[model samples]
Target chain A: DAGVTQSPTHLIKTRGQHVTLRCSPISGHKSVSWYQQVLGQGPQFIFQYYEKEERGRGNFPDRFSARQFPNYSSELNVNALLLGDSALYLCASSAYGGSGNTIYFGEGSWLTVV
Target chain B: QKEVEQDPGPLSVPEGAIVSLNCTYSNSAFQYFMWYRQYSRKGPELLMYTYSSGNKEDGRFTAQVDKSSKYISLFIRDSQPSDSATYLCAQRLVGNEKLTFGTGTRLTIIP
Candidate 1:
């Protein structure tokens, strides 16, 4: 089966601009989560959506938000971006029932802010 | 201190040698442990996953979790060049799906 997929593989933005990254979860998967990985750092959790409900949220600022669609796809939005917002935004998907409910990740959207 | 700690190694080893990577965590509430392998500029691929504590083996890969010490490890036996990649340890607390990840260790198996 195809794995989770993310769009806008790369993007360039400037300070004060907004950006939206998208993700399509794997077939049969119901949960979608977003993470941000700054250079030299591990992925930091952002938001998780299950069955279209916001399940969990991380310590990100109000500038960051996300939503899951009826199709189990998701979008992560960042407002008034800052240069520090430059990072790889990853999307992961998992099913409710599984041995470990492993969260499989997508290729990620590389966002570069100037 | 971070919830999860791992050495960000650019560790190099000869092919066919044994390799071990580890992570230490401070959150005892974390119950799900996992190891992921990621190539340059790519998303991490799940290599191993375990619950609570104990060891799990798959092919030449072994994952061990020690709840008492809040430690976890991944070992590769008879390692191959293809095994060269960044190994990341991740954990999630019981009843929650959010994961905390290590900084990752980059391994290179030289031929």
Candidate 2:
């Protein structure tokens, strides 16, 4: 079966610009989560959607938002981007929305803000 | 203190040697422990998952967890060059979906 897949493998944007990254979860998976990884750092959780509802959110600012579709795909959007926003955005999926389920991650969308 | 603490090692070892990677957590409430291996510019891949305070071995890799000391470890035996990558330790609470991760330790296996 195909693993979690993300789109816009890479992109660059200027400060104050907006960008959207996409993700398609593995077949039969219903939960999707987003994380941001800065250089030399581990990934930080951004948002988690289960059954198309927001289940959890991280400490990120209002500029970051995400939503999941009925098919379990997800989109991560960043508004008024800042240089600090430059990082790899990762999407993870699991069979369900609860704990104890194994989560699989995508290759990630690399975003650069100038 | 950070929720999870890991030694950011650029640890280099010769091939066929035993490699030990470790992490410490401040919270005893973390019920699930996991190790992830990530290559350069790639997402992390789950390596081992452990729930209790014991050792779980898979092929050449062993994951050990100690709740009393709040320490977790991953051991790689007969390491290979293909094992060169960053090792990350993560933990999650019983009902929480968010995984708190430590600063990863970079490992390089020499040929």
For chain B alone, what TM-score does every candidate structure achieve against the true structure?
Answer: 0.98, 0.98
Candidate 1 — which residues are off by over 4 angstroms?
none
Best by TM-score: 2
The per-prediction CA RMSD against the true structure, in angstroms, equals 1.1, 0.9
For all candidates, the clash counts are 0, 0
Q: For each candidate, report its DockQ versus the true two-chain complex.
A: 0.69, 0.76
What is candidate 1's lDDT per residue for A35-111, written digit by digit as tens?
99998788999999999999999999999999999999999999999999999999999996745677899999999
Candidate 2: list runs displaced more than 4 Å: A97-99
lDDT scores in order:
0.94, 0.94
TM-score of 1: 0.97
How far out, in Å, is residue B2 in model 2? 0.4
Question: In candidate 1, how many Å is residue B77 off?
Answer: 0.9
Prediction 1 global C-alpha lDDT: 0.94
